[model samples]
Target: MLKAVILIGGPQKGTRFRPLSFEVPKPLFPVAGVPMIQHHIEACAQVPGMQEILLIGFYQPDEPLTQFLEAAQQEFNLPVRYLQEFAPLGTGGGLYHFRDQILAGSPEAFFVLNADVCSDFPLSAMLEAHRRQRHPFLLLGTTANRTQSLNYGCIVENPQTHEVLHYVEKPSTFISDIINCGIYLFSPEALKPLRDVFQRNQQDGQLEDSPGLWPGAGTIRLEQDVFSALAGQGQIYVHLTDGIWSQIKSAGSALYASRLYLSRYQDTHPERLAKHTPGGPWIRGNVYIHPTAKVAPSAVLGPNVSIGKGVTVGEGVRLRESIVLHGATLQEHTCVLHSIVGWGSTVGRWARVEVPPVTLTPTIPEPAWTVRASSRTGSCCLLSPSWAAESGSLPRCSS
Candidate 1:
């Protein structure tokens, strides 16, 4: 049997996801009409021999998270549990901290995934590679342009043998085009190295004159402390994929990831896509509408739109390339494009909520106009380009 662990960083970690993370934990934030990490659970459940799944994070197991876990367990028929960390543990720390729980069932191998990434999750392919060599570490990697590669953990692999010769975490200089996807498959033997890192940190902690200055001995960065250390030691290998993959680090990236997943729904979850019934809203392309959402027939939504539960779309409303979150109401004739409608907020009649479309490419920086919701009011105000130019930064709006 196999298991999967999803590392969702705690509250202090996803500050980039401000207001949204304030309402819901980053892992529970909706993407493509579902909580972001649900995609990870669904993908893991599909893998053969997959036995259980665990979520390791520092967030309190609140009601929303608890409900999600129960639903996932029922839907997937697998034990889905959350393992909370009392303190912030780096990527590898949680794995080592919960080593006994993870190894209890003697899983053949377990998959470790980061919560902030979106991908097709080529787990089976990675499993095949692992079975062939039974390497201690199998990292999923994909190509990025030379410059963008510097933003991620870069891997230097022996092309013919696929052995990772060297690894660098967001190096200052150009390293390699192949970047780590934050997805890994590891044999049980992998924990040994983590134990070593733990022991080393403990030893180093004792020598520190001021222990408070240390990040804590429990912190273990999987990339720097493991992959980078084990490269070329005949323990780490890389599996390259040309599939759809992107990191959801900011609001713009989340919007782009929504589009990517919406497109994938055609093959993966067609029923989730909204359809044009006789009197239903006119959906132009891939769209997801929760059953509880009330959209008027004249409203037009499409080409990558997700309407969450309790949302109300009025007649003649135009929504495209956006997400309308739960409990939001778009009044009649309101035009929303390239933005996110915050939960429990209402757009006035005929209001136009928009921002220039952002096209994500390695060469272009993410657009500055992606409006983030306010944690206090669950609403956002968009600033004009001129105001942004004058201020040299986007204005933070509330209510």
Candidate 2:
């Protein structure tokens, strides 16, 4: 039997993701109304050999990973387990730390993947190749057309044998466009390299060589140390794929990924706009507009706008690219482009909301505007391009 483990690397607060990851855990962030990690779990569970799944991560100790596992188990009806890491563990460190638990189960091969990613890559196909070749370790590689690949790591694989020849981590000089997809398949033997190194170096009294012996050693990054060292010996293999994949590591990437997933969703399941008069000008995509809501015929909504019960869009209002949680109202002739109008919050008539031109640059795209509220009426004022404290609660609207 084959089992898989997804590493939900703790709260990614240190990165530029900032405020977005502040409220909910990074893995739980919604991508097209579904948690980000769901994409990974759904893909992995469909694989033939995949039986059990373990989600490993360090999160708030109060609830820990239990919440995520419960939802996943109920939704997927699969045998799922959540193992909370006491401390932050690097990729390899997290695997090594959980080595004992994994060995206790004793499966044929285990799959590991990064949680902060979206991809349609055929995981089962890769597993099939691994089983056929009987390789102890396999790394998933995707075409690296972006420059960011240089910062992560680039893999050079023997085309004929499909074995990893060299791993150049954060190379300044360009070579292969095949970049590490932050996914891996490992047999029990993969742990030997790290365990053996630590055991040998510790026995030799070389404290420096065995970082695991130190207090905060669990943070020892795998890509920098373990994988880099193993690549020199050609112990790892690369499987390159040209499938749908995107890294959701930053705020900007998150928005892009959400749009990307929504676009793909449209291709498979085209949007069916409910023929309700109140649901005005609904774009034919995966959008959910409440029947009670009054959207003016002049207003526009779509690709991923979800309005809640009793929400209202005033006449001539233009709201695209946003989620109006519940009872939110866009006042008359207001232009709420690329922004979220919080629940029960009302954008004054003639108010304008476009991406902050200052934050805008010719080089990069703008972040999606998000407004979230519960019970308080929205501040009746014209919102600027960028407002610092944009979220609040409002009372439930009567009409």
Top lDDT: which candidate number?
Answer: 1
Tens digits of per-residue lDDT for model 1, 1-399 = 999999998989976566667778989989999999999999999999999999999999999999999999999999999999978888999999999999997999999999999999999999999998899999999998888898999999999989999999999999999999999999999999999998998987733365555477788889999999999999999999999998887666778889999999999999999888898799899999999999999999988999999999999989999888899888777778877777787876656666677675432566656333232334445555444323322333323
Looking at model 1, residue 318 earns an lDDT score of 94
**Which window of ten consecutive residues has the lowest lDDT sum in model 2?**
390-399
TM-score of each: 0.92, 0.77
Model 1 TM-score on a 0 to 1 scale:
0.92
Q: Candidate 1 local accuracy as lDDT? A: 0.86
Screening candidate 1 with a backbone cut-off below 3 angstroms (N, C-alpha, C), the clashing residue pairs are: none
For model 2, the stretches where C-alpha displacement exceeds 4 angstroms are 12-14, 61-65, 200-215, 267-281, 284-299, 304-317, 321-349, 356-399
Task: Estimate every model's Cα lDDT from 0 to 1.
Answer: 0.86, 0.65
Per-candidate clash tally = 0, 6
